[model samples]
Target chain A: MTQAVATNDRATTFDVAAVRADFPILARNVHKKPLVYLDNAASSQKPRQVIEAVDQYYRRHNANVHRGLHTLSDEATAAYEAAREKVRGFINAAEIAEVIFTKGTTEAINLVAASYGRAHLSAGDEVLITYMEHHSNIVPWQMICEQTGAVLRVCPINERGELLLDAFEKLLSDKTRVVAFNHISNALGTVNPVKKMVKMAHAVGAVTVVDGAQAVPHQRIDVRDLDCDFYAFSGHKMFAPTGIGILYGKRYLLEQMPPYQGGGDMIKTVSFEKTVYNELPSKFEAGTPIIAGAVGLGAAVDYLERVGLDAVSAYEHSLLEYGDQRLKSVPGLRMIGDAVDKTSVFSFVMEGAHPHDIGTILSHTGVAVRTGHHCTEPLMKFFKVPGTVRASLAFYNTREEIDQLVDGLAKVREMLL
Target chain B: MNAAAPDLQDLYRRTIKGQAALFSQRRPPAIVTHRCEGSNPNCGDHLALALHLEDVAIAALGFEGESCLICRASAVMMADTLAGATVAQAHEFSRRLDAFLHDGQPLPGPLATTRCLEGVRAYPSRLSCALLPWQTLTRCIQPDPTYATTHLEAKP
Candidate 1:
């Protein structure tokens, strides 16, 4: 792959300082030191562009959308719809009707489980998921399976955290009604072969649902290209606000499924006797949606587009490699999840210090890494670790910050050991 | 780096770090009668407490699982302090530890070494780590001699 050459040379081209300038939080000191936010897997620091977009919405165009005929309502509706269009284009979904707004990836997954899985799955049906899935992905399927009297099957990962495709193939059967998996593992940073997996799942007549929460930030996602039935992602991880996310489902599928939540907007006409559901996108968005959050997400999309995701992806690849090289110097630091095609995440355990101690120590030096199972408790159990100290990178992150992380880890070792 | 920033030494006191490193003092007995598991959902700190009780007294106690330095150190220190103590005394000790951490009450005489954990109160997020062991203890000895206060009384 040209990944190595492209990233090494593209380093000079990707101006990180310029990107860093756009994020105000990066300038703030954590404790007494410059904030080196390595917890992008959990959430990303928002750019001023997104912050101002939300601010502008509240300051100028604050109104309830879709219902009101006032000027403010019209503007709010226009902006919110514009955000949906942006999201639709961002994921290259088949139609705007397929994009549904929800609270976040967790809720999006739950919606699909409650609506689609409930209707389709039954006793003797199987729901397939991976060992590396976040709790959001795993628990929803479990809840749905439990409700439907369906069985849950897990595709196991190898020692290096790569999905055993052969094992996954073996598990897929005619009884497999749904296959849910993560495009990129939040805990392990393993980039699953989505297209191949989707093809295999389709062979067994299993509809595919991808948890793209961690993938969307590091790579461009095209739901149509992957041929997955449903793609779920969170806005906050992609530099948008919390409490806003998107679920891209195929038009034909969403047309058949019932509304997830029964509320004001999800219904076209409701009476005591009968209730008619709204169309595809509106059917799922039950209540007054996160309007300002949508605007912020649109601005975040605009900012990422301006930077060019190709450059961002390439830059992060180099950063990940550089981080790997630098962290080798940290004696007794055991790297977890070294999958071949992983993205910008490093989960590790130190010999002497606990992951929490490492996190606590590193934060003192202003390196904000995540510690624990990363909402993937099953994966952590598979790896035989209590939890891990994870440093997940973004395009705004610099090599210098990685160096700082390494230094901080060395200090953590010294203090803890 | 800002000079005003809190030092790691403040959180990682020598005694606590030493306790975490040794961990030898925390070992399960040959026969564990009571077992309780506690987990901190936020940071994924999990711990299992095992109590080998003889006639309502803690004959031996130990823990196994993954947790933070504060939690591990606290668990190690806890095992040392509660060995041979009756279930009633164990409950009393938990209340005193809770009061000491939350309400600034003096630690019982036996657990003076655990005072090093007081440093964790400054880092509110780490307080749960320090309390997981105690909470697991409360969960282990239930119904008969309940601890007066909850594990995380202040909800740090």
Candidate 2:
């Protein structure tokens, strides 16, 4: 909030320096040191384009969207709906109607659990998820399970934090009415084979819900190609503002499920006897939505498109490789997840220090890293750790910043070990 | 502003580090007499205290948990000082430790090693870590205590 927006796009191939310039917070200092922010999985820093979009929306078209006789209302409605279209195009969803806006990934997942799982699940039925899911993906299904008397089954992960695909398939019986799992682990950075898993779940007549919160920021996501029945992701994790997220459900599924909440925009007609519901997305989005957040997300999708996801993915892969190799210089620091495929997260633990101590030491060095269970308490239990220090990288992060993290780890060793 | 690195070096003194090292050795008793478990839900620091009470007086104390050095140090040092104190003295120690951390009050003789944690008062976020054990010890003396939590704000 303290920085200015500068659209400094130097034309180069995956130029991280130019990319970093677009985000002003990267230029600041924390604790008198150049801030090395590696907490992207928690929520990514926003770019100038996204910030300008939200600013322009409030400045020019500050009005409630959907229906009004005024000009500002019409402009707001067009921009808000245009934002939805941008999101639909970004994820390559088949129809804009399939994209519904919610608060965040948590709300999107809960909407599916409340609307779909509540209607479909019954006593003695099963809802399957992996051990690596965040509490957002886990607790919603548990609530629905408690409501419907359905059993919640967890597909186990291996020691490397990779989902056991064989065990995931074994857990998918005909009784499993819903299957929910993250496309990538926020805590461990293990990228699950979602397309393969979705196919396996569909083979057993179960619909799959993919938590794409961690994946959307790192790679290109084609909902049609992945063929997940429902894909959920947040805007803030992809360089946009918070309070806006997208849930891309199959048209047939969205049409079949009832409304998650009953309010103004969701209803076509309300009488003392009965009320007629509205169309696809509006039927799900019940209230006055986060219009400015949607506009910011739209601009974010544009920025990512202009930058190109393939370039971002390849560059971040190189960064991940460099970080993995460089972090080995730290003594007594061991990685928690050793999956064959990983994104930008480096979750680790030091030998003699607790993660909170490591986190405080890192903070003192002006390096921002998340240190906790990351809302994956069951996964932490599986790994036999209280918590792990997670340094989740973004494309804007440079190799020099990673070296600073290593230096900070040395300070932690000097003080704690 | 740049004094943090040196301040941290000064904070984790020998007494704090030595007492924190004792945290792992301070295990739960096999007899399961007067043992209490508590946790800081914010950072997942679990603390279990085992104490021996001899007719309204404390005879022995030990702790087992994974927390920061400040927390482990506070728990271990408190256990060491309050080992043979009466029940009222244990409560007094807890109250005085709260005062020292919050209001900068000077600690008495047996709690002299606890002075190493004076730096903790500057970081309010770390206060719960230092207070987790004392609160749990308070629960051990309570007749019907279920769980423990550290509330850092001004209480009504």
Which candidate number has the best DockQ?
1
Clashes of each: 0, 0
> What is the RMSD, in Å, between candidate 1 and the native fold over all Cα?
3.4
lDDT of 1 by residue, A1-417 (tens): 112327544434777878888999999888778999999998999999999999999999999888899999999999999999999999999789999998889899998999999899999999999999998998889998999999999999999999999999999999999999999999889999999999999998999999999999888888888999999999999999998999989998899998888898888898899999988789888889999999999999999899888888888988988999888768998899999999999999889677878888888888999987788888988988888899999999988899999999878877877
As a whole number from 0 to 100, the lDDT of residue B69 in candidate 1 is 73
Sorted into a CAPRI-style docking class, model 1 comes out as acceptable
The positional error of residue A61 in candidate 1, measured at the CA in angstroms, is: 1.2
Question: Which residue pairs collide, candidate 2?
Answer: none
Compose the digit string of candidate 1's lDDT tens values, residues B12-92.
Answer: 766677787555557777898887778886666767677898888999998777667777888888888888888888878
Among all windows of 10 consecutive residues in model 2 chain A, the one with the lowest summed lDDT is A1-10
Alpha carbon lDDT at A230, candidate 2: 98
Report how far residue A5 has shifted in candidate 1, in Å. Answer: 7.9
